[model samples]
Target: MKTGKLVIGIFSIVLSVIIGFQSMIAGLGNTLSENGEAGGSGGFILGILMLVAGIVSIVQRSHRGNAPVIMFVIGGLLGLILAGSYSDLYIWSTVSLVFGAIILIFNIRNKKIAQQ
Candidate 1:
């Protein structure tokens, strides 16, 4: 398995879990207000999208397909946009970017290997 894909997949999955648990934690702590509910929902949705994209990227990389590498970049750009949109959640965005960049680098490396 490509280390790049595995790392991204794990990070995204972990982030997704964290985003999901944040809501649960807030609810358990009785800290969620009406406004907070909607506010957090965005993270939750984005987390899931990232999670799915990450998984697909990994699967594609394992198959040696180039299409999934593009997905990584798109996911990363989206994460960057999301990070800028919400200062409090830039960590996820950063992780997404790293994941995408790593995958892209690995893809380039693999292509070079194939050419050589």
Candidate 2:
């Protein structure tokens, strides 16, 4: 579980970096035409949320109990952001959501195991 959380945290930070860069450069000629500001601040927030949730899940996997729930919320927000995209951000948003869900489920299972 610790390893899983570490991997997830790193993955989430990658997501944050990617989205942050995309947002910073989104005002370019054609990038904003599709992605625009949709994935700018919103995606950035979700990415940060995922990052935090991932770290929390990892750092407190045994001590804290609600880590997976945090991830579930992040995944839901990512899914929502993906829904209103211009097809260009579908891949990024969907990928983030997938990672968030994976983290969520992994933590949930880990929590259960810890209970036993």
lDDT, candidate 2, equals 0.59
lDDT of 1 by residue, 7-47 (tens): 76777777778866663454443333433333244455556
Compared with the true structure, the alpha-carbon lDDT of candidate 1 equals: 0.59
Segments in model 2 whose C-alpha atoms lie over 4 Å from true places: 27-37, 68-72, 75-79, 82-88
Model 2, TM vs. native: 0.65
Worst 10-residue stretch by lDDT in candidate 2?
23-32
lDDT of 2 by residue, 1-116 (tens): 66766676677667767765664554353354754445455555555666676667667655535664556466546646643543434665566667656666765787788799
Error in Å for residue 103 of model 1? 0.5
